[model samples]
Target: MRMLTYISVLFLAVLTVGCGGVSLPKEDIFSCEGFEIYPDSIVRGNRIYRAVSPREISNAWTLPDSTTVAPEFISTLPMADALFAKAVISPSFLTPEEIWLSLGFLRPEESMQALRSLAWLPENDNEDFPYSTLSPYWAAAAWEVYCATGSRTWLREAYDALTRMLSRQWKLNRSALSEFYCGIPRGVTEQSTFYPASMDEMSRFQTFSASVNIMRAYSLRIASRMAGELKLYAEREWEMEADKLAGAVNDCLWLPDLQRYGQYLYGDYYPIVSSVTDNEANLLAALTGTATPEMSAAMVGELPLIASGVPSVYPYVVNQTPLRPVVQALYGLSAAKVRNPRAFIHSMASVWNLSLDANYPSLWPSLVMKGLFGIETTPSGLEFRPMVPEVFGGEKQLRGLRYRDAVLDISLNGTGDRIASFMVDSVSTDSHSLPAGMKGHHKVVITLSGNDLNAKPLRIFEPVTVPPTPEVKWPTANDMKIVGHDRLLHYDIYLDGVMTQSISTDNYHVRPGECGVVTVVPTLERGSSGYATPPHVCLPDDEVISIHASSITPRRPPLHFIKDPATATNYIELAARHNTRITCYVNVAVEGDYFITVGYSNGSERCGIRTLGVNGVDVATLLFPPRRLNDWVHVYPSTTSVIHLNEGVNKLWLTYVGGTILFNKLTLLKRS
Candidate 1:
């Protein structure tokens, strides 16, 4: 009877495989000839080759060539986006409390840390929470990492942090509309200057931003997924909250006339006016499943705005090409996956070409794996539901993909829009799912046929590496002493003349018996075109040595002396009272006349006056003129003053005379 039962099960299994209902292990299922070669060509020798995009140049810092995967038939935009997302993992600019995914070419970690800081600051006892703008989509970025790496450890860590952040956000920012959340007050938002919403600068008070709420819902859904993996009961609450938020967004934020969601709703200020239509918000709605199928279709219909490429905003905000819209647009495209794959491919290619022309490294490659390849993480395992455009013919392969404990190498042979057959390893399979608990290397090859199929894969040439000019020179010990006025980009510090540490600071302290050589590099050269005025640097011939005043201890006062995370430097602020003063003790290595340049910001209408004194002797009354209100990340150069410093420790005093000013660092440069 037992033998009969085993035979019956065996028969069922064979029957299922024969009927194409179950996969059967087979030897040599298909040929690999059609797939494109991956790890797209990279220039070998480098002075820092200007790759087609900025991130491509920077990608060498993290992703070595051996680990990179280049899939053929993938256009440059999606390729660049994938590379940028991989490169964005860095230490948080704020407290290195946690790793963060950066927003863009600027400080990338700040993109998510800003939001985390805002949400967790009030709840945590830690006083040193770095001040950054609030971002609601941090979890979404984290989810990308989880999907790519398949690290349960990373997922758990991210899950805990996001849960705490969500709880705090609920407590502080949640709207009276139940699961809905309000936007940060404009004053606070302006201070951070990093919210993803499109409110006019004049928009007063807090309102419910559709983007933020959708982001919250998206994050909750991700958290719920993570919780379920850990078998945590809290997953129910997260799912419940996500459902409620989505419903609220549809019920309250949807705009009937536009057939899209409104940008924001005036919080409790009735008859609510929802005037603006944000391209990014609508895209997010589609990407996160907040939008209905009809809404998704309507949003996808706006692909015409990309005449040649995608714009940051539709209806064109003058001089605005924010990264959010581009990213969101790609997400929308991936989510919609409309029937006209050829049009989408053409539009994406156009955007890629445009990005190359502009030298902007947009993160478009994210669309390749997530959209075109249609790779998704299921509880069972990784699922591949590719949406290959018929235009991209021949064979395309994605190699060297790291997923948890496995390495996935995927190959697709396309003759047309549809995949005729697919093979997993040596096994013949028609299933879309790769069952869970897959270990080691796995390969999936899909074959398609149509009239438009090309015989060869599309090829993009590797960037040419231009050698540095003969005049280009590394800084010597003498050059290190000359402080350039441009923002200190980084420092290569050597101990006993051997490279030891690399830091982003103008100041360093040498311990006893340890000789140190510090080289400071600036963000731009003197002739760079961004600023109107050339930066003031000590002449190459100047007999100068700079002491980083920020490194010195300042005498306590009524004002706060805080480290500005944006620059990773200390600055003093909030000294509005009379008779307030900050004193820094500086050790002068040489006795000579020096120019004392204080980095500060005076944004108010009135000028800030301060008395500069050397060892209690008043030297000059320094005047800081009012400049336009700038982002807090900026530190402008103050007018330089000549002062004599005796060898050994010299006391420098900034006596408060009036007005408001943010004092960054003080640099003492010896005169020629």
Candidate 2:
């Protein structure tokens, strides 16, 4: 009987895996190849790159070349929304004495500390609880990731946190629970009382939108699944409670007239009332079943009208209404409506383009492709579950959907009967046999900016000395004195002794280091006259070194190196006691050897160039063992294999690796 049961289960698994005689081969939905990128696409890419810098894209787009490539626009969701969410809550809860704790803002260890503190709150007799501000949003996001992946560890952590949150919620405001006022938990300790400066005006009822009810719902959904897996009664209770809360929310917040849920409280005097146009409310309404399918469809259909500003004077405006576009694409494509599905897609594309225009970045493209294009993967190979629109125009070609260590590119036929190609890490190739005739969306997620083989190196500072002072040139011990105004004291100034230049001023505005530079010609020759020198070099103790200037007046205005170029090389020279960094606009040509040189000369010694590259890309170069040259250096890309160079302008950046070095010029070029 046991053997028969095992066989039955296995058969069921197979049946579920291959249902309706339709099988989907794995494919990537986020493809950048066919899109008509504008001529200034590079600038948009730069914006995305900078917005999510230092995090390195890791989800939905890892390729075999050891590179993590995230769609610049698509990767911003995780970067910005996540950041905004965290920023909103960090001030209140991530503090000591809070019963319900977090890892303290963005730091995981700090969160652990808060959690541990909450676990042992009995010992800390402090009166005010902190972290109530951000708890719900953080927990909701955490629960979201766990649900999306079904990861056990995340579920476990989330369960523990929920347990603590429930305990605190029950303790602080038991009446709130009964009144259906489950929002941000109140502070039990004094330390956590100060909410964000912006939220000073928010009423207590408005706090649930911070994280409460939504996270509880998501958490309950996951707990239910986990309980089934582990046969845990607590999980069952959570699931029931989640459903109860969902029903309560529907009853309290649903607005049938507006086809959306209200933000925070339901009544008109409740501070944050429902903006009939708010997208989040619509999404919550649909997810919580507050809005009927027909209503949901209406909300989706009205997206084009809202976004195009048909009812209002403005068009293509985005301020605090995320639901207008995301929900339109997410649920619009999924819902069954008389309107062409492609119209929803077009609407989504237009909104996404608007976001780009306004300089917003996120993993939006990936979400659209996954939700609308329906390209997902399962345990039994891969799945291509596309939501084919009647007006889809034709087939769509997509490349670079990636997993932990796999890359899958796919091409879909309009009729959904064709399989174009499959490559994992640009090496393993396979011919896919996709079983045809399917009509359901698959769940395949590709990580963004992940698995980039030619990954750029971290920006590091390298220091190079400009004036290599030898032991012989050093003054004897008896002659050494700490001079207050020594002529050789300027760290980043470039001037040869033979130049016969002397510069000084009163305590007025642009007096030397204050901002502007003062240049003057003295009566001395380039080699200098007698031993004392003639250019009026200031001694260390001299308050001011008076020099015969053609004229003496403050500079027209102070200049910032970042705003205007002071050097001829276009390289902004920065003074540093340790290392210096310079940034320019330049593209790497090949994937091989690259060098960054800093040149300097006091009309004598030359500062040699330093080479730095990873996989032949000039991500960064550091010159070690600082030598003084005070001359121009060429930072070039040298390689065994040729890398493509784009036509037009590029910025080149240089930094001192270690020990200060003066940079006179900076350049980006292909090695000869």
Candidate 3:
């Protein structure tokens, strides 16, 4: 596969060299390889890409690689009329987040229409959740809007919207991605298909991506900068928060061995090992400086490549693999900064190939202009810092480039990442920055300053090394040793699929014979991790097990054990607002669906509900109907739907969601 990629890459280099010396046409928009790319065409979608003509949406189009709106997405909805009555006034394409990053290459004044065409601050009345603000993707597009136009009016409006969204702080859904913390839950993010139903429920719960935390840090930093600009007093506070969050990400997600940041941290409080790395995580880590300079070097030097370009996530799983053009551009831009020309070319090739696969022949030319050519639209004018590779050797000219009221004809003659000389309309600027705000047609010329004497012949861009999956031994019924990683912080014990205990130290002990089977996952120091490792079920044993609530320890504080004539056993009293957790192991002889009945007392006027968890996975929501105010009830009043359980030890846990309820006992009966 490496040889094939190398060969394909070599073929591309040959084609590039063959076409290098030829003069490009004088077009209003950039053109190459028989394709025309107007700055607007990239987002509006050309005939070359999958152009949708949805009646409700504007003329703009979604990226061929992005989420595709179904043909009948709005048309097939039952209440389309009522739901879309407002959007009809100005239908928009919300698919402009990543695409916004490319706006950095176009002048702000000229590109305002394109920028404005995007569904501004996309969301419901008070719901403005931004992916870039929540996850780092290198190209800061929303920031480009102000940089492009230098409009303080737009800045103030955006600033206000940002403040309003930040005020809410992602409380809409308790598990939604938070702007200032590692808040998004794995169950909320992943679908059932992300992990098979047979797998341990812990596979995807309470997991938080490093990108979210890093993005929060970036958001705070940007907020601080903007606040200072807008004369808001909280700049210092936001700066401190940004620094703290960045430091936390460094402390938590670093994987020394891989020299990359782990995609996420799994588990609550103390996390288990989530030894996975994705393309987006690494790119963001490097681009945002979340990864140390040394770590960034390691990433560029050692991160492996997949059959396609950089795999969206390392260890790309079948069918679950994700592809996004925004992701590729960021990765390529990072490599460009590091002077690895191969990475940029390969990314462009990857996007070209991706376009072929999606049947969208045209690709984003900004990948070449903004990233490789290093020509950026600036508040003053334009900044030129070309990072030309050997393949693009010889003179290159870009004409009819729009900047405010000016049309630019930029000519480049470079082979390395430095400008030997630069001039705009016969005027010299030592800063290599020329004013685009000046009116009328203009000419800009730049030549490579660096010799690049040691530039190697074009070959394979990046190495392809697939890291081995990390594993740990399962614990036994009796006491056993903890298999630890060098960065190990703690360990979690799961029986069958239920998580029973979290061990913080070496000495591990549990009941023998009657205990459920166990599996273990490591917790890294200062970080959390988890596994999709399926639990072992179906042991040749069977019996009725009743777990008394009094024997269990409350996962949270301030719980009472009340004694009453309501039942044979005392019950654990969960306060009205205290969210408590009780974890237990259920040993069954047969693998089949079973009914779970709980003996509890709920005398409050309002009904109560408890979330039931099996193997650390949220399985069902249990309802505890209210009883009379004084009547103590404990006759197994609450029963759950028949939950499938493997023969052997399985986990059964309940979380106090609302109302006051006394947990007396939990009994599991095999369904006949």
Candidate 4:
């Protein structure tokens, strides 16, 4: 692989590929602007390319390509590398997640952001969106923001906002599964709660989600601490409430034998982990203090991972990327020299043909300030204990990091947690901290002993039990009405294998027109019920037709090979390599009317992402995770997505963002 520089103020085109597979950059480097590069410096890979800064150097962040900020850094770290800066810093680059992550480095007001899905909201109303993003992680994110800023004013405001939020929007949802508790509902997923069903998102399934509840529990604990510091009266109440939820999480969801929490639970005490892989719920359980120390220790000994990055879920219902796992688990596992998240990201992008930026900038700063550097600010003072992973086995430096009224320049040599020497302004200090009242620019240097951290090894990535792919049972034609189990159970209605509606026994409905092949998968509070559905024509109450891949394909039965869009006008074709700025047409109907699935093959190590367009507008970034190809003879993987269709014919365009894909066919299911 070689570096091919495409000079642009905001974009840096860095491609890495070899005959064997994806090749990583020779070195992971994010250097300070003051670091000089000669007119033509030699590098690896034949030393054929000239090394030059992509932009002018400044006292601010020196990296030539990323956002120019007040801080300066020269890092050769793995996760917290040069590309981290490029994720988001400029207002134009702001994303919902990035704004939360930016609080450590940028001003709070500058980082205030609205949901990308809700970007249509009015500008004046944008400021309020942060408080109402419908996520269980809000309180924890606010705590991190305060940790980075050390602002009492922000803390007080955050505390007040959380109080009101808990009373109103942030309160736990009522649950039927647990008779005594209300908690974060199932499918609360990530920070956002709504999207066109593209990846079997948890949001599409409403149940009791352990990950969500654990976050809610953690938030309450943080809120309680904040209240005590501020002398608020609700500290005890919130703490007790947090304890209640945390207890419920362990009692109901913890899979003791598996050493992890189940993904979710049904209303009547059925855990859904029988056929599911453990995910963020466990990380949240361990990190949030929701789990006991014993439970956490057990988790450290177990927890499996995907072939590349740690996946969100295994035997994926759809394409998945382990973004949360990387952010929350990697640093926690620094003692074990766990896999680097950046390597997975690059490898995934190499297959997806898209380099994602501005989505996770804050994660880098969080991992650095709170994980590797281990900077914690309290009323007493500030403590700094670097816990660099073995992957970052070298010296790294950061300049102009603002905390309170001080601008700090810190350098760490060697890696791991063993500290050999600590010095502030060339003056050695016995303690690894600074006075709270100390307010001045200072240079601090630290050296590691290069010995073991003495910390318990974080032995994640242990093999988890893989349950059988429970058989899917489709509703028979004998009944238009769906029935639940004699015991408490529910049903998931799938249109063309894409789940559309989940109905409980009490509120079953059979809407005849707004569906395709009708199959009802019986969902128990405990185990899997393999379900099936078949293609059935519904008279177009609104001119809707059940669409097959044949609607746009020239062949039937067997999925025809997708030729280049340039030549195959009638067949379903996507853009191939050497063809940028190309748009291919797969005119289906309008959205809110169809669920789409694609049959594909990916033998790479990492997950790939592709954009799905509704009409001509891009609605979702779909993931295509790696599967065993056995040279295209083994697995023919498939993923489902929702596409709304109009009353008449609608042109759904799948743009060739980049890279070549092995997608063969598109399956459309009519959706409500």
Give the winner by lDDT. 3
Model 1: worst 10 consecutive residues (lDDT sum): 527-536
C-alpha lDDT of residue 595 in model 1: 64
Every candidate's CA RMSD: 22.9, 29.5, 14.6, 18.8
| Residue lDDT tens for model 1, 1-672 | 334433433554465457554422221111111111112212112211123232353234334455533332333322444343343333334322111121221232343345345445553221111111235556766655455445677677778888876764552332222455554422132321222233322122235667777877888998898898789998999899899989988998886665667656542212142434555677677767888777776655533233333433333323334333254335335342543354355444443433332322223344455556666655567776666555344566566655556667887666454657778886888786676677899988877655342222222222111111011123542333323422423343433223455545444454434432222212223211110111123234333444443554552221333344534344556256533787777777788766666777655555565777887687755545455664333566554456778899988788875667777677666554
Taken over the whole model, the C-alpha lDDT of each candidate is 0.49, 0.33, 0.52, 0.48
For residues 497-518, what per-residue lDDT tens digits would candidate 2 score against the true structure?
2222233311112224322111
Report the candidate with higher lDDT, 1 versus 3.
3
Cα lDDT of model 3 overall? 0.52
Best by TM-score: 3
Stretches off by above 4 angstroms in model 1 are 1-134, 174-178, 184-205, 271-275, 303-306, 316-343, 354-362, 415-418, 449-672
By lDDT, rank the candidates, best first: 3, 1, 4, 2
Q: Per-residue alpha-carbon lDDT of model 4 for 347-421, expressed as tens digits?
A: 222211111222345544555565566666655567876766555668877777776678889988887666889
Work out the TM-score per prediction.
0.48, 0.37, 0.57, 0.53
Distance (Å) between predicted and true CA of 328, model 1?
A: 6.3
Segments in model 3 whose C-alpha atoms lie over 4 Å from true places? 1-96, 104-139, 170-180, 183-205, 318-322, 357-363, 377-381, 453-672
RMSD of 3: 14.6
